[model samples]
Target: MKRDFAVIGLGRFGGSICRELSMEGMEVLAIDIDEDKVNEFKNIASHAVIADSTDEATLKDLGIKNIDHVIVAIGDNIQASILTTVVLTDFNIKKITVKAQNDYHEKILNKIGADQVVHPERDMGKRIAHNIISNNILDYLELSDDHSIVEVKVGAKMLGKSLIDLDIRANYGCNVVAIKQGKDINVSPSAEDKLKEDDILIVIGADKDISRFEKHLVVDE
Candidate 1:
């Protein structure tokens, strides 16, 4: 099934999304106020349009109704971003994603009817901070507003214990979705599988539950 996507603003976020969607065999109509940016993505996107996304005429002319998803990626100009999002929603474009510069911007985007609001910079900062805070925590991915996926080392506390013995699901309210042992990975790790000191566990749970799980690894002084 092929889905059509329309992206407003040809900046990094929008441009990257258009490229990816096009690569995935989806038809993407890329839009930007700057002709130069539109030209840059001409080869990558299925189609590129140079127009002010805040203008209703441009959106109507682009055949926004055919688009299954519309992403508003205007940068720096919060007003332009919000205006573009509101216009797209008014046109009844399904699945709108807006880039927000700050908390205030996020709230505005939410109020303006954006299906999703992203804070790329703040999200990256949190991921980096999580990796730096613990040697055990290898990576972190937010699954939803309340849930996340985390990669962590098994460490000594969990060494020599089987999945059933640890009872991670009962204790942590999370599941070990995958196991990474050196270069080898086991998706859907079995309950009978023994955990080693260095095994990397891919866990999925609420953000608060993940925090509590990490704390259990540290020995109290």
Candidate 2:
């Protein structure tokens, strides 16, 4: 079956998601308390509606139950964000993603049943900062509280080393997700594949583990 998504709130965060999903060919329903915001997303998302998302009855009337996933992106309004997420859960929507304003908001969303809580602004800032801090790292993404995904250039130190010989997962607590060779990426790489000096690896693990793995890429005299 095809997947459908619903976006509640048309702020920058929500607006970007709605537009991206629409562009990716998913059927998306956009919602907001502001008519202008809804109109702004018109002709982009498959559907757009102006409604108060804090009202469970209103969400139900909008057929939120049929949505495969619902995104709660209400900006700065913790009450509305929580209420919307709870209501979506009550309706038994398959998946729910909420944007939290801060740690407290994220905790509340987590305890109240959001399948995923995103801190877009904070995460973007962290990524930018981390990229600036490291030479090998191209990017980083927090997969969970304990785990992250990182991309790093596989330099001379790691070149010609087989994954089994290096034992990355065992030694560094990280796993190579993919290898980027020039323009192509090899996903689900075999353990015996050798890392070339120029290869870029997409790895996943705990934040600390990634730091250790990045150290492994450094060349010694």
The CA lDDT of each predicted structure is: 0.86, 0.87
Q: Count the backbone clashes (under 3 Å) in each candidate.
A: 0, 0
Question: Could you give me the TM-score of model 2 versus the true structure?
Answer: 0.85
**Weakest 10 consecutive residues of candidate 1 by summed lDDT:** 212-221
For model 1, residues 156-195, the per-residue Cα lDDT tens digits are 7788888898887888788888899899999978888788
- Can you list the residue pairs that collide in candidate 1? none
User: How many residue pairs of model 2 clash at the backbone?
Assistant: 0
Tell me the tens digit of each residue's lDDT in model 2 across 1-221. Answer: 66899999999999999999999899999999999999998889999999998888898898999999999999988998998888888998999999999999999999989999999998999788777766667888988887888888776677798888788889988888898989999897878988887788888888898877776654232
Give candidate 1's whole-model lDDT.
0.86
**Model 2 residue 187 lDDT?**
95
Off by over 4 Å in 1: 180-188, 196-199, 218-221
